[model samples]
Target chain A: MISLQDLTFSYRKGHLVLNNLQLHFEPGRIYGLLGKNGAGKSSLLYNICGLLYPQAGQCQVMGFNPAKRQPAFLRQVYLLPEAFHLPDVDIDQYVRLYAPFYPGFDSAAFDRHLDVFEVPRRQQLHALSHGQQKKVLISFALATTARILIMDEPTNGLDIPSKRQFRKVIAGCLREDQCMIISTHQVKDLDSLIDEVLILENGRIILKEPVTRITEKLSFRQVLSLEETEAPLYSEGALKGYAIVAVNRREEHSRLDMEMFFNAVMVEKEKILPLFTR
Target chain B: MQFSFSRFIHLCRLQLAANRKLYLLGMAALAGMLLAFMLFFLITDDELSYNTQQTIYMIGLVLSSGVFTTTIFKQYAEKSQRTQALMLPVSALEKMVLAVLLTLVVYPLVYTVICLSCLKVMNYIDIYWLGNPNALYWLNASYTPGLLIMYVYVQSFVLLGAIWFRKQTFVKSAVMICLIIIGIHAVHSFLGRKIIGSAQPANVEAVGQKLGATGISNFRYDGGMPYINTLLTASAKINGKWDTEYYMVELPRPGFAIMATVLILVPFFLWFITLLKLREQQL
Candidate 1:
């Protein structure tokens, strides 16, 4: 679990990156953190991981102040940074060296994840392609079995197939006691995988709602024409029809289109957020 | 929370595993370079004194250690590396201890072995193979404790710089150390002149003879290392030629105490600052 209260952060003194934020995350669910570029998405991740100290306020993860970075706290939280450098060693050597740091590290699970990722277990990390290396690190991050696992832009650099496999591994590896927060721009890549959506904008998380609740409140659909439908909260034109995000007032069942929902939040910030607030 | 020997050892193992290749290559390069330098000196300087050989050894030791210390914290140099380093499940104290171990203890010990081994081989070649008229032997050379201590003292600043600077660590550390030394020396000189007088001590007769009048002679204040040196001069006839000798005399201690305390305590303070820097490092 993670909690941030009055969490103000900035790289420079005058400019605020994440301003007076309040948020909470619980175990047993994968959180998809969505935000625009420079929206403090990575900054939030870094703050939670204690790589960056907040300018003001508290960031408590698993009842420990991450900034303290006590060994016990660190052992429970793993950050899969957007850009990471793997050592110039083979996978087995890396595992041998680092796995002991995490008491819950499961070698069999690591091997299985790697198998799913299709990364060669014996090759030097540097020898792998960028995506393969990302997969390898992703596998390791999951295998650490940390209570909190954060992946920033986890799907980046992955081919379509690898991204799908990434989702598969993520779906399988998450334990009930583990809390996974994934920050990514590619919503579709993880829409089916994420249990909750955290939309960040203007240095604050404007939306933190479960996918099921979102589906319960709003309907995502495509219609060739919107003239005959009820008033839509947000709508965007597609090649064949208009993708609309409308209030689910009639109890009609519809799958949540994450891209449509994200667009709806951005465009109808005033109109759409009210539905979720209620 | 702060220090765990088991976790520290695990961290060390991880560091060694991660950098085994770099370590091996670095050891090879250092050995080659030291051997080459020894060979060059063995061939070029036939009349080398113990002083010259030891000077080379000390200089080489400090230089190589400075180089090594400058690179020991490359993990903190880049964003990606910094993440992995800080995220490792080891306390900041453990990481700092490892850095200290590698820079102050491990690297120095291994380097000394390599240096002495090279010197030993060179000495044999000089005496037995080259048949040199004069040969510098390691066993005969005596090192000044000050020089060896100064090596640790000087490299502490480099260690700090390596932690603080992201790039150009070695050169920047060297520059910073020079400036700090210069500043400390200036301050020490000014204070010494003020508290103890600017005049250099001379023998009693030259200053105006007083049987008990005494002040420190051969006084030294190099940066933070302050000393009250005493000199005794003696003359002995060897082969009908007089060889002059001098013996050092003791002096009072109150004035030197303040400076000595600060000077002696600074390495630990610098190391503490380095640890704080490591803890506060952000990416």
Candidate 2:
């Protein structure tokens, strides 16, 4: 679990990236953090992982202050940045050197993930392609079995097949006490994967709710025209018609479309705020 | 605030895994350079002596140690590499200690071993191949302590520079060292002029005896002691013959003790600063 109370952060003075922010992440759920460019999603992840310190306020992860970066706290959290550099050593050597830092590291799980990703176990990390390297890092992160796994743009360099494999590996390896937060602009890559969605905007978290709760409150449907609905909160023109988000009056069940849901939250924030505020 | 020897070992292993190739190649190059220097002296000079070999060893040791220390924390100079380094699940103190061990302890030990071995091989070639017995010697007991003290003093600043400057670590550190030396000399000269005055008394022998009593060896009392250059050429009796030898400025016993204390304390001070910098490092 993680808690952020009035977390204010900025790279430079007078230009806040995250301001007076409050958030809590619980275990047993995959969180998809969505935001526009420079919306502090990555900064949030860095603060959670103790890579960056907040200018003000406090961030606690798993009952430890992440800013302290204590060994006990560090061993429980892993942050896979958007860009990372691995040593030139081969896979086994790299694992032998770093895996000991994590007490719960699973070598068998690492081998299985590598097999699933189809990454050669003997290749030097630097010699691998970008996608292959990303897969290796992703696999390594999952194998660490850290309680909190915070990944920024996890699917950026991955090919389509590798992305699917990444999802499969993550889903299969997640334990009940584990919490995974994936921050990305590409929502479709994590479709049907994340249980909760956190939308950040203008240095604040505008929406944070589980998919089921979101779907229970709002209906996502493709309508021929806007006039078909009484009051549509948000709508976008689709190939067949307009994708509309409206209040779910009939208690009907529909799968959540992350891309559409994200857009609706971004555009009709005030309208959606009232539903998820409490 | 915990220290684990096992975790420290893991961190050291991690650094070795990342940089072992570079370290090995660097050692090989150093050995080759030492061999080349020894060969050049043997072939070019009619009489190869231990003094010449000592000079070569000193040069190689100082240069190599400077390079090694300045580059110890090169990973922190770049954003991507820094991220990987900072995110490792080890305490910052462990990382700092590992770096110090490699640059300060392991590097000098390896360099000395390699240099001595190369000297032995060169000596063998001189005695067996070239028919000379005293061409080179493997051991010189006089230089070890002085060389180590100088190495620690120089490496401390270089290590600090590596952490302070993000790029051009060696060049910047070298330049900063030069400036610091020049600044210290300027301040010392100004203070000496102020205290000793610009004129000398008529009793030249009296001034010389006074300075000599204080353990200041190389001073001329013609007009004023304009400057006290650290490097002084002094004439001394060697083998019952007057010989000119280059010596650093000789201070009084108490002054020498102070200098030695500073030399010993500098590395620890710089190392502590580096640890603090690393702990607060942001990427």
Candidate 3:
């Protein structure tokens, strides 16, 4: 679990990137962190990981103050940074060197995951292609079995097939006790994967809820016109007609369009968040 | 209460893996220089030769120290390595302790072993110097524990410089040098003016008697002793080489050395705290 209480941060004095921010994450689900280009998504991640200290307020992960960086605290968490340049070390050796630090490291699971990703255990990391390297890190992060896994842009450089592979690997390895929060602009890659969604905008978490609840509360459907049909919650002009998202009242729940939902949240944060909260 | 040696060794192994080639090359270089020294001393049969071997040795010491310091910093904050290091699930103390060990104990031990082995081989071939062939002589006055501790301390500060400046360590080094030079000049000018303007004749006589005129001169008395004196400047000038009486007055003591060790470790501890405060976040 992670919690941020009134956290405010700035790289320099008086320039707040995050202001009076409050957010919480709990285990048992994968959360997709959605934000615009400069929505302080990375900064929020950094604050949670204890990489950047808040100018005021507090950030805690799993009851441990990240700033303290206790061995026990670190052992329970893992950060897969966006920068994918690993040391020019072979995979097996890299595992040997780094695995001891994590208390619950599963070397067998790591080897199995390496096989799953088809990452050659003998090749140097730098020699791998971008997607291959990403797979290597993903596989390694999964193997660490840290209670909290924070991944930034996890699907950035992956090819179409590799992205699917990434989803499969993550889903297969996910433990109910571990909470994985991934920040990415590619929402489509995480469709049907992330259980919960947290949308950040303008230094605040404007929306946070489970996908099932969101789908039931809001419906995404293609419509012929912008005309009101039972007062749709949101409508965006599409090519053939107007694409609208309304509060779903039907007995059956439809699959949520992550990209459309993300846009809706970004465009109509105030309207959509209150509907879910109520 | 304290970090485990096993953990330290585990981390040290990782550091070694990061730059094994450079470390091996450093060991070879140190060994080569030691061999060259043995060759020179063997031919001359003199411990203190007229040649600039000692000067070369001093230069080598500075260069090696710089390389060692840079290596320590880069292993922790190397652009290629920093991200992964930050991702590791270990305390900042573990990272710092491992860095210090790599810089001080591990590298020095490797160099010492290489140097000693080369000397041993040379002695077997009947090309020995320093005459005694006591392998333990490498632990002479030059290899004092205090010097090693001091070097580690300074290197740890540079390691701190690496983290604090991150990618701008070279710039940090330059800025530090500039600041130190400016400070030295300021302090030198202030003390110079004060000592010359107000130094009393009796104070000079008293200093001369206590530390001898030679020792007092090393203290760099520019002229008349100042009446108004600051203890910091006077203490800075109290060296004993040229100031012979001061040399006798300020002999080394084990108690002071112990205190100095604690002083040297303070910066490393502070840097360790900084590392803890600024860890890599969850992605």
Candidate 4:
């Protein structure tokens, strides 16, 4: 589990990136953190992983203060950053060097993830292409099996097939006691995968709602005209109609359009969040 | 918060495994440079003077210390690499200790061996191939206690600079280190000027008791070490022979404690500070 309360942080002295921010992540869920550029998404991940210290307030992950960066805490939490550097070692050497730190590391699971991604087992990491190297690291992060897995831009630089494979590997390897938070700009990649959504805006996480509850409270539908409903909370143009987010007063069923939902939250927060509150 | 020997060893293994290619290549380059310097000396001069050999050994040792210490924590410099380094399960103390082991212990040892080996090789070439006798081979300059102690002492400061200045680590560290040494010297000189005034007068009285008034003119007195018994010894080649002109003065029993404290204690303390700085590092 991860918890942040009144966490104010900034890279520079006076300019705040995350201001009085508060949120919690519990086990048995996959969190998709969505944000625009400079929305403190990566900063939050850095703070959680102890790469950046909170200017004020506290962040606790698994009963340990992340700022302390104790080994026990570090072993349980893995942060797969948006960019990473791999040493000049092959897969086996990489594993042999890094895997011992995590007591719960599963070599078999690691191999399974690699096989799923189709990463070459014997290629020197630096010699591989960017995507292939990313795949290797992704596979390695999954294999660590850390309790709290925080990934930034996990789907970036992936080909179409590799993205699908990434989703499959992530879904297959998640344990019940694990909490995985993936932050990415590509909401579509995390459509059916993430159980919860965390929207970071204006240095705050304004929305942290589960996908099921969001669907239960709001309906996402395509309409031929704007006047089909009295007033939709949000609408965007589609091929022959419009995609709108409306209050699900009649409890109609529809799959959540994460892209539309994020946009709705951004543009129509006043009108949209009230429905979720109820 | 944990310190396990097994884990530390594993961390050491990881550091080596991660940078083995660079380390191997660096060592190879150092040996090659030493070989090149010796060959240059053998070809250019009648024989490779021990002084030139000592110059190469000392200068190379100092430069190598700065270079290696600067890179010992280069992973902490960039964001992407910094993230991986900070997220590693090893404690900061373990990381600092690894840096110390590499820069302080292993590097100097390996460098000394290479340098001495190069000295031997050049001596053999001078005698066997070039028909030059009295070729200087061994370099004992770096092995002296004073030089060894000073090397570690300066290396600790350079390591701190490396951690503090991420960009242009070597250049910045060198500058910062030079400034600090200058500052310390300035302060020491100021204090000496205020307290001691002129040491010549005190030595003049001692010289008057031993030799004539003109004998005081021959002796040039510098500041003495802050120990109980101070040696005012001077060496002069008298009557066509190198002779020791002993003028041992026993003032107190606080012999070399200040120097010992500065050299022995300060480096360890600086290393501890390095660990603290590492612990506080953020991307």
Best by lDDT: 4
Ranked candidates, highest lDDT first: 4, 1, 2, 3
List the candidates ranked by DockQ, beginning with the highest: 4, 1, 2, 3
Q: TM-score, each model?
A: 0.90, 0.87, 0.77, 0.93
Instruction: Give the CAPRI class of candidate 2.
Output: medium
Native-vs-model 3 lDDT?
A: 0.70
lDDT of 3 by residue, A234-277 (tens): 78888878888887878356788898898887777777878877
lDDT of 2 at B1: 53
Give the per-residue lDDT digits (tens) of candidate 1, residues B150-185: 877887888899999989999999899989978976
In angstroms and one decimal each, the interface RMSD of every candidate reads 0.8, 1.0, 3.5, 0.7
* Count: clashes, candidate 1: 6
DockQ of 4: 0.84
> Which is superior by TM-score, 2 or 3?
2
Model 4, B1-283: lDDT tens per residue? 4587878999999989999999899988999998898788767886777777787788889998799999998998898899999999989888888899999999999898888888888878777877877446455554666667779889999999989888999999999999988886666456444544434445555555554333444333333433223433343233354334545444344545665555467888888888889999988
Query: Scoring only chain A, what TM-score does candidate 1 earn?
Result: 0.97
The residue-by-residue lDDT of candidate 4 on A1-278, one tens digit each, is 88899999998998999999888899989999998999999999989888889999999998998888999999999988888999999989999999999999999989989898999898898889889888888888888989999889988998999999998998787899999999999989878899999999979988889999999999999999999795898899999789999989999999999999999999998987777663
Residue-wise lDDT of candidate 2 within B162-187, one digit each (tens)?
88888888889999888977886666
lDDT of 2 at B100: 82
Better of 3 and 4 by TM-score: 4
